[model samples]
Target: MSELSKQLQQLQREIKKLQRAGTVPAAASAGDESKVRFTAKGFVSLRSKLGLSAREMALLLDVSLQTIYNWEAQKSAPRAEQVKAIAQLRGIGKKQAKARIAEIEAAQA
Candidate 1:
C-alpha cells in the first residue's frame, strides 16, 4: 500500500480505537466555552444578530475597525483572546449588547 493510504488506515484505526474507548475526538472535545469555533460567517452573523455595525463590533471586541472588516472578509481570524471574548458576547441579547456598548462608550468618555 502507498504511504498515504497506510497513513489513512492508521488514522481510521485510531479513530475506531478512540470510539471504542468512549473518548471524543479532539476537535469535538473543546467544552462549551471553547466550542464556538470562530468562522467568518459566524462572525458576520453574530454582528448582525447584535445589530452592530463593523465599527461597533470593533469597539465591543476592542479590536481595530480594520480587524472587524478582516474577520468579516475571511482575510484573517481573531486571536485566542478575541475568540474568547466573542464566545462570551455570543450569549448576550440585544438589550445586553446595547448596554455593553453604552458602557464601553461611557468608559471611553
Candidate 2:
C-alpha cells in the first residue's frame, strides 16, 4: 500500500481504539457526530447486520426503543457515552450481538 494508505489505516485503528474506550468527543452537531461513524444509515446498516430488531438493539445499547428509531431516522445522534455502545456493536457479529442481548436481558431479569 501507499504511505498515505498506511497512514490512513493507522489513524483508523487509533480512532477505533478511542471509540471502544468511550473517548469520542462531545457531540457537536448532527453532521459532526457522523464523523464518529454513527450516521443514521450506518446505524441502520449495523442493526441489520446484527439481525436485531429495534427493541433488541435498544436493550443491548441500554437506550429506549424510540431512541433507536430516532437514530435510524436521523432525528438525533448518539451521545458520546452512547457511542461506546455503538462501537461495541461494530466489533461484534450477528451471533455475538444476540448473545450480548441475551446477557443484557438476563441481567435485567
State every prediction's TM-score relative to the real structure.
0.68, 0.66
What tens-digit string does per-residue lDDT give for candidate 1 at 1-109? 6999999889888877774554543343334545657999988999999999998898899999999999989898988878888877776768878888899999999
lDDT of 2 by residue, 1-109 (tens): 6999999889778876775654542332123544565678888888898899999999988889999989888888989878866865676678777888889889889
- Global lDDT of each model? 0.81, 0.77
Number of the top TM-score candidate: 1
Q: Which residue runs does candidate 2 get wrong by more than 4 Å?
A: 1-35
Candidate 2: 10-residue stretch with minimal lDDT: 22-31
RMSD, one per candidate, in order:
11.0, 8.0
Most lDDT-accurate candidate: 1
lDDT of 2: 0.77
TM-score of predicted structure 1: 0.68
Candidate 1 Cα misplacement greater than 4 A, ranges: 1-34
